[model samples]
Target: MSLVNLEAVHKRFGEFEVLSNINLSVSEGEIVAIIGRSGSGKSTLLRCINGLEPVQQGRITVDGTEVTAANADLNNLRQRVGMVFQSYNLFPHLSVERNVTLALKVVRKTPYAEARDIAHEVITKVGLADKFGAYPDELSGGQQQRVAIARSLAMGPKVMLFDEITSALDPELVGEVLRVLEALAADGMTMLLVTHEMKFAKTVGNRTVFMHEGRIHEEGDSRETLEHPRTPELTGFLDAVLH
Candidate 1:
């Protein structure tokens, strides 16, 4: 069974439909890259999967839980599906360790010592072991973003959702964050990312999804779809991004 599934999903805001008849699935340990122009519903789709946004129609299931069901445990769902946005969203007043462990301590009721250990583990995973005692303001944009990723990973999520996580970084700092994501993929962590980093998408993604006008325009093997786009929409998009 698919680890993540979206069947005939539709989303709208004030009569302006944002996602239309979207159907997608993601397998465990698969990395699926979602690429599209702004307002193409890429981020919205990720939010829906994490249960941050409610759909107007259809069903979404992640890790066998029906995310769209009225009685669904959103908190539990969110814990299982982690999301990282372009903005780091770290607590400026808290130390990196505290920021990463807050959710575990508060939400999961994990003891302080246990949460701290988990924080340290995830921080090391993201190459920020030494920065655990540092404040968010003391870190660079890339370092802060890595902390944000560590915060999510500390939850031990079954799947991760990344929404343009590198868009806010300086070009020089982008590599560090992407390298962390690369390592996660290498570890067989299931991930779905909406990104503009075409090269990373091609290299790290097992499958590529091209969304256009709120719909999936094309999808297939990442290298094949990205290198040889079959549809005019995808071809045009690649041309615009590649050059």
Candidate 2:
């Protein structure tokens, strides 16, 4: 069974349809990448999955829990779905350790010491053990984003949603962030990434989905989708971006 399934998903921002007739499924331990032009609803779809943006029609299910319903327990759902954004949204005032531990302590009611230990473990996994006491501004963009990922992992989420997480970084900083994500993918973390990193998408993703005009234009094995694109839209896009 699919870990996430969307059926006829639609979204509108005051009658301007943002997503139309979207249907997609992602299985557990799969890394799926969504690629499209800027306004093609790629980020909106991710937002909808995370409950950051409400869906106007159709259904979205994560681990079989419906996200489109008005009565869905958003807080509960959010805990299972962790998100990383283009900008690493770290709390400037908090140390890296505190940032990672905050959700555990506040939402899960974990004791402070226990949360701190858990935070340390995750930060270590992200290769930031020595920077635990550092603040966001003190770290490089790559380091800060790693902390952000560690924070999300500390939540023990079942799925991770990345919305152009490396788009804002310097060219030199991009690889470090991608390496962290690659490690996560290797560890079988179910991920849905909206990215312009074609190399990573083609190499790391189990599947690649092409979105155009707010709908899925095509989807298939990453190798085939990137190499022998079935749609004219996809062929044009890969040409413009890759060549």
Candidate 3:
């Protein structure tokens, strides 16, 4: 069954349209990677699904909540959809454990001891179990991003949305974050991510979506789509980005 669905979704910024006629569905445990050049509404799409950006038209439903509805419980909806961004937005003063558990304690009314336990579980998932007591500044950029991922995982989300997560990392550090994502995929965590790492997308994503002019231009199995793009735009995009 589909955990997330969007139908005829339209988004605009006053006179400028960012997304148009977007219809997409993602099933449970599926990993979809979105790829495109800048200004193609890739990140905007993620925000819309998370209800961070409201759509002008069409419907968005996540885990059966009608996100476009006026009476939809957005806070509850967000709890079910976790998002990790390019920049690791960790609290400078908070320890890694505190950083991961703040939302659990505040939003979910979880107690400190229980929240810390949850933090440990997710921190281990991201391969940062030893860094629990450390502050964000003490870690490398990659370790910081892993903590960000662990923070989202600690929420016990049904689906995770990643918005160009590794873009801010140094090339040498990118693999560490990617490996964490790979482990998540192995464990069957439903994910939809916008990314520039084509090789990782092909290997890890069950499906690849190529966006152009604020719409999904082409999409299919990741390996097939990347290796043998049918559209001229997708073909050109691969050549430009990869070579």
| Candidate 2 local lDDT, 42-130, one digit each (tens) | 99999999789998889999987888888888898888999998899999999998999999988999999899899989999999999
Where in model 1 is the C-alpha error above 4 Å?
A: none
Put down candidate 1 lDDT per residue, 115-199, tens digits, no spaces: 9999999999999999989999999999999999999999999999999999999999999999999999999999999999999
For candidate 2, list the clashing residue pairs, or say none.
none
RMSD of every candidate to native, in Å, equals 0.8, 0.8, 0.8
Q: Which should have the higher lDDT, number 2 or number 3? A: 3
lDDT of 3 by residue, 1-243 (tens): 699999999999998999999999999999999999999999999999989999999999999999999999999988889999989888899999999999999999998899989999999989898999999999999999999999989999999999999999999999999999999999999999999999999999999999999999999999999999999999999999998
- lDDT-based ranking, best first? 3, 1, 2
Question: CA shift at 148, candidate 2, in angstroms?
Answer: 0.8
Looking at model 1, report the run of 10 residues with the lowest lDDT sum.
234-243
lDDT of 3: 0.95
Q: Who wins the lDDT comparison?
A: 3
| TM-score, one value per model | 0.98, 0.98, 0.98
Q: Estimate every model's Cα lDDT from 0 to 1.
A: 0.95, 0.93, 0.95
Give the higher-lDDT candidate: 1 or 3. Answer: 3
